[model samples]
Target: MDDRRGSVLVLTNLHDVTTDIVLRVLAARRVPVVRLDPGTDLLAEASLSASYGTGGQRGTLRTPSRDLDLTRVRSVWVRRPSAYDGPPGLDEHDRRFAREQAFWGIGGVLASLPHAHYVNHLWNNRAAEYKPAQLAAAQQVGLLVPDTLITHAAQEAREFVACHGSGVVYKPLWNSPYRVAGRPHSVWVREVREQEITEAVAVCPHLFQARVDKAFDVRVTAVGPWLSGVRIDSPDLDWRRRQGLMRCEPVDVPGAIDQSVRAYLAHFRLVYGAFDFAVTHDGTWYFLECNPNGQWAWQPPDVTDAIAQALADQLEKGSAP
Candidate 1:
């Protein structure tokens, strides 16, 4: 009965390959899609107007080339938060302040739409991105979780490693993108040697975990009520560290695992997620983490096709697809 309904909204970076595949599927399916990349679009003549009162907030987003009524949007897929940069010629401090302003200003409005079925909503994605929260939810759903600790004290880290006789691994609190010598750098998950826990640990909080003796990695991509999984086998500690070197095969997820995954998604209020598990030789699936809006375009051919089709279905059919 609503007159303001409109196209599906996708918030993602321009270079996201998964977004590209899904967009193509939506195009072939004749589903209306509005793509917004905050990094490039937010400041370049993108407009938003929201009204606040007793009935709550209602608004419209206007790009230079199109208009989207917030109340009309079928669904929103927040793939990633873009970089907000200040205008040219500002000092470092002033630039940061301006970027902050841009982030809150435009981002706040997008986050306030009155009627929309977001695949992984911004607020929910933010919460589920935390590893601790994910692990807690996994345990509650009867999934085995590795013993974990988040600390900055070297002594505490050493003690944790000693207590966890199976040995321990170190992971970044978050995979924050940065650069070194003007080139991109990243922190990959790797095992920790007791002697390597040095004074540098005091620099910031670090995540340490008991290493799971794994047979392989399982990546399950959940799209609404449907689920598909792939087993990853590689010589590297983190298969993603050497993407092309890893072998991927379709996995038949057990009913129990499927139910627990559904539970995890419900706990985070997400319609889509990429769940990672470490499978032991004994067939135990150890929960590692979940990416609310993970990459899928690079998966094997059949997996990619299924994912794209699933996303296209969701966009075309709205809440039920």
Candidate 2:
């Protein structure tokens, strides 16, 4: 089969503007694309029938717009798709059972698609999401990593903060959706003092790191062999909170940082990554966490377009097998 003739299967929710950018690029190039949300589509707006034998696995997935031949998928872009919620109406117990089936059944099929190139394979994305794993990988690749500690003990948290006399910051291991008083809440990076450590720290594992007295933050978005570095200038500790007040400009990636970025991606077998770095006054690039499936559409227009084009190029080329 000619891989180029196959369609690009996009797995993302309807409101994902990032996926929309890439889809537009694909459409402009006349690449066949089939976009669907497994969460809401499977068992509702979509249907599937797959089989396996001596000839290998084959199936047909019917989405609202198109019927995708599982064997003819050139690549899959696993974007921010919600979890399988099962069918619309069901009892709690039945819903749980149906969700599980949808996940392992249809999810497994999507993961097993032969000769399909995944931007960042779902398994790889899962492993890279671990902060511990990411930090270890960055250090192994010769990147400058700040002193860090992960603990569930109050005493340990206090000691960590005390030892880093310069300062320490608490960062959540994962950005799980949080709510306060019926309103969405975000946990931003904030300086933590030794005195602030309380017995509540023992209730859960918390991450603390020596804060880098940085000049600004750098967001490097990598797609395959392409890398786009953006210098973000903001007065706040976390620029994301006040993006409108921040200044963004395209910057050249340092040779060493570029090499380390590629090595880090190779370590996790990821074709895409959004790496964060804290650059100090002395021009040191301190390694921060890399979001394996991070958002890049929020970047400046030119950078976003470049990333979209690069991603589309990868999907169009598919994978060599």
Candidate 3:
């Protein structure tokens, strides 16, 4: 048996809502966890103290900063770091350093350390951010994918729209957060008609794809080696389009699809992924995209429990979680 004593460190910004659920699950398994936000007041005293302490020596864990021996940490779950808008009462110069430290200073230093099983390493995640790369990777793994085009020229977009007839959909390539009247607006899947493409292409390079007339939606949540498959059905084109009107069923994932997903995860070096799929009327499954840090709490409670259990098991085993 592999014997190692360590605590799981979750580095996430304050806005993340999943931390509570994950914490509760880890707590239930008696796994120790420390939450660190680099944006907060850096407890240099505590960190320096911990850094100087002998390895494996019992010490009081502090807030904002805790001594985590790289080798001992079983896993790390990194969500976005807290946005440092500056401390309330600090001078501008100090606050600037604080903000920089959150993402570049301590944050960068800690991430560069050579230990711990990360959910999705920042560099890997950054590399996988390009849609073209993801599509190529998905296709290489033998997953059926829809025909897509990424273009800035209006003529190219027009041609793509015409080729798909009424079966085309447009989405943002980078998913830049958009605002309308100071409120966030999400892009919804809609039928792309030729008439709608007049000047839209000139505005930006949009991602257009053949909109699959899906028979159903599938969300495959992969955490470590575990997979939780959920079938989503809705009258709308996209289940996310009408949130409250969708139905979900716990289903067994096909072996091939599961294998493809596993390969996809490995290719991206991610321990967790929320993959969206479109099952066609002909029974073929088409991969849409994989969200490295997708939301899984909304899935059935049983599914959540299963994922949480899998994560805990991985962490306890000192493997990827």
Candidate 4:
């Protein structure tokens, strides 16, 4: 196996259609690619050793089939890496500790890749994924944003709801898996009633925002400096909830919103972002959120191809001439 580091490492889920598309693009370019599901399959086959010394730092990532010199890696595309599924043999407590170590060990080392151009670096991605941080960055960059409040106090939530009306929506801090009826479930973003603001909210922090009275929603997937937006018109509050009921068309982004979006990306040092925007009836665009490592393969073919090419260019070119 080649020990060179000039390969694109893809961290992804078990069944990622986008990863398959991206892999095809890379293959067409004659680029070497290594794809793995870190939370499950990778732990068994992947081994990484990183060391720091007086001279410099060096590391190697190895699978039984191949070896990659960490210093030479061209790019690391960190997609949606799920949590570590602990060892099947260990007890819950021991398994938890084991998983924690693996996360900080292998995961931390990957995040510290010295020469790799991360599509959206893991640490940066994590910070930018915070909805509150996304909102703050959007507002700071002069983008119109709906009034929002994140709180754990029931009274505070009630007051905010009263202020924003029944249209105020409750957004999950993160869509983590919850066991309901012994089955996994997720809490999606939904409208909240003023009466729904009860002591139950005090159990944890909840994000509430004044609903953007909208005609449509815009999904802008930015690859490096290139931007592609899809205008989605739907009757649903969350277009994603009922995507089949929506009409998506390619649209040009206004210069002002484009500039603000560029600023937001710069603030987070992200090379790629899937930005969500709420467009009002009067054609005003309100910033929703930016998923630093969001999916883009679901976009229109032409747009997806462009994004693929742009990403390939970035990985191959790096920051050097």
Question: What is the C-alpha lDDT profile of model 3 across 23-122, one tens digit per residue?
Answer: 8878888888877665553443334122324554322335544565544666667766555565567899997876676556455555554446677676
lDDT of 1 by residue, 1-321 (tens): 242245888998877766888888888877778899876676678867778889866777899888887778887778865778877689999989989987887777777665567777788888999988998999998888999999999999999998987889999878888799999987789999888999899999999999999999999999987899999999988888989899999999988999999999999988889999999999999899999988887788999999888877766665532
Q: Which candidate gets the maximum lDDT versus the true structure?
A: 2
In TM-score terms, candidate 3 sits at: 0.85
lDDT of 1: 0.85
> Order of candidates by lDDT, top first?
2, 1, 4, 3
Alpha carbon lDDT at 118, candidate 4: 88
Question: Which residue pairs overlap in candidate 3's backbone?
Answer: none
| lDDT measured at residue 169 in model 1 versus the true structure, 0 to 100 | 94
Q: Is candidate 2 or candidate 4 better by TM-score?
A: 2
Estimate, for each residue in 163-221, the C-alpha lDDT of model 2 and write its tens digit: 88889999999998999998999999899998899999987899999999999999999
C-alpha lDDT of candidate 2 relative to the true structure: 0.92
TM-score computed on alpha carbons, candidate 4: 0.93
Clashes of each: 2, 0, 0, 2
Off by over 4 Å in 3: 1-3, 40-71, 84-101, 319-321
Query: For this target, which candidate reaches the highest TM-score against the unseen true structure?
Result: 2
